[model samples]
Target: MKTSPYGAIAFRPDARRLTVSAPSGELTVWDTSDPSRPRPAGRLRTGRGIVAAAWNPSATDLLATVSNDGSGALWRLRDDSAPEGVARWAALPDRPRHVGWVAGGSWVFSMTGTGRTSVWDVGSGACVGRADLTGGRPVVGAHYRGSEVVAVTDSGWARLWRPGRRPSEWVRLTDRPVSACTWSSTMLVVGDLDGQAACFDAEFRPVHTLRVARERPRALACADDGRLVASAGDNQAVAVGRDGSVQWETYLRPPGAQSITIAGDLVALSAGRPRPTLLALATGAELAGGRS
Candidate 1:
């Protein structure tokens, strides 16, 4: 089977559904009931490259995407046909780079290249709040967890804020710029260009740090068992235990991994390869021939 390079990947909250969006704006959903061989479930075309996507926490079939066309859209996937666009908003000053759902999918938020974050009401498709968070630095990545959003900038700063309020928790993660970030139930993990993954508590206190990659980590995901998985571009994908020890590392093909998702005991890596690669989260061994 032929496959285009993927720009981003996401798994449903339940981890049963996986979505991979290509640079051509084609989004494909996969049924991961058998993690080794994910069957294509559905597809949607946005007409522009998707930068990021997030699944609705409460509605499994609902997905949100931020596109290179300076728009954000919500899509509804059906079993019988291609997904439909339920709501879309455009005309932003900068292209949105990251998107996420909040308030149990009642609202959606996106962050742009200029550090502008906008929150839209899903029901009305109206942007209810907008804020500039750059503070003279470029935002590298952002993560939405619960009602709060954390934005990390190239200046090595991370700020936690809620809509209509100033940042309540802010911290300087490192002197080196951060590359990726993700949230677990009780912890926030940030990876830096220095090849380190740092864990912080709820109050922005440093808990521990693990060296996951030789250079920058392209993506980071926290597993259910408190392990940190990181993809280092052109390097390798690694899983680190809670004790700041390396659990396993699997080398990748050139151009390396772009994104990662962990569901149950399986880890899916979207890389330069033709198809996504599946690895055993516990042992880092390829599964089902490693192509899905």
Candidate 2:
């Protein structure tokens, strides 16, 4: 109900707020403190179009949204009013669609239109390093769990990049792209475009392939304690527990949900056209069903 599908979504660390970007060049935050009734707390407009949006983990009211027009702006919200511009920003030679906050630091990571990824020092807003990505439209987002940051490109490949030994030398993970990828604490679940899902280690080596639809999933979300939720274009979503149990199942039923997220025990889904709704994990039923 809060975020727009044209961009990206990042949940605040406390799970009380969410930031979403839409095709209208807008980014908004929703208050989820009371899951039974989510409310739009604040909103910000982006330049050009939003390529991606990410929430600052520790700072609940801060967010960074990147645009395809090659500019990144940091917005801070104190109340529901328009966001106040902040000090962090960047203008690159190429447009970037994916961005994330680095763990243990204020650095920001981004993937460019040319399939190039880079890290920036948020305080100084300077580029620290860069890596080449397997060419594609661009990555939608970058994820970091530990020391390694996983960047998934539009080509359906997951590239692992750690800090280079020296100045600009990055370790190339592989020439081959993984079909699909989502991460847990110690494991990564990769779904290929070929209609298969595989598990991999931190070293990017294959371990196991899982059973599910192999036809490329539309969205993927995982819980910190090791639960995986996947939804294809088919409108049905499946919750796969880490211990191998069915958590629940439900369909949005109409215009279809464009994206989903797990906050606490609730599954928040954004449906297209009609409106957005939140479902309880225990019953797979809507908590707040509102018209768009």
Candidate 3:
């Protein structure tokens, strides 16, 4: 399959669909019905270039993307065909730093580099609420859990906030920049540029920390059961136990690791090389024949 320079890759909540967005404004959708082989399903051309994207939790065909052209677009993709211009539900102002759905796809949330976050009603296309992040740093990523949003800043801080409300909790994670973050059922895992990753419980208590490699840990994923965590960075990848013990470590031939996604015990790590390789989170064993 032909590939481009993608900024982020997102697998649907059900792991049935995959979306890859390039910085050149190309969006490719893949059908992952066969976990071992993902076939390109459709493509959407956006001249502005994508910065970040997220799939709606409850809707398979619905997703949101933030582009460098200072616009955020909500799209309804067709499973069988390429998306056209009309598939865009709405385009909002300012380039979003991160985007995700909230309230079971009832609303869309977008964060900006200026510490501004907005909530839009997905059905009505109305601005429902907005909040200012006082962390004084650009938000790199955010995950919606229950009624609160956990956001990681460029300055290595994680702050929790509710729409239209002030920040309720904040934690200083590291001095080095946070590269990526993932949230599981009971844990929040964050990777940093210093080649370190940390896990925290729901109440923001530190569980374990691991120094996985010498390179920046750019990609991170955790098991839903909170038993394992994995990180890939700078040509090195490792899975660590909940107690911070190394389960496995290997050198990646790729130049860098792009993203990590975990579903159940299966973890997908997308290296800079494009295709994502599947590994067992429990044992760090690469799942054979399941490269997407």
Model 2 collision count: 5
How high is each candidate's TM-score?
A: 0.88, 0.80, 0.82
Whole-model lDDT for model 1 versus the true structure? Answer: 0.73
Stretches of candidate 1 off by over 4 Å are 1-5, 78-82, 167-170, 233-235, 288-292
Instruction: For candidate 2, write residues 1-292 as lDDT tens digits.
Output: 1133533666665667766566676666777777777788776666676757777766767777777676777778765566798854554557775676775547667667445667776787787776665445345335775544566554555555664522222333334344334554456565555545555566656665554443555555556555554443356666665544556667666655556666566666665532346777656777776355
Ranking by lDDT: 1, 3, 2
lDDT of each: 0.73, 0.60, 0.67
**Clashes per model (N, Cα, C within 3 A):** 0, 5, 0
Q: How well does candidate 1 score on lDDT at residue 227?
A: 56
Residues 129-229 of candidate 1: C-alpha lDDT, one tens digit per residue: 77776664677667765787778776678876688887655578777678777676678777788778888777778888887778887877788546555
Better of 1 and 3 by lDDT: 1
User: Could you list the CA RMSD of all candidates, in the order they appear?
Assistant: 3.3, 3.9, 3.8
Q: What is the TM-score (0 to 1) of candidate 1?
A: 0.88
Q: lDDT, candidate 3, residue 95?
A: 61
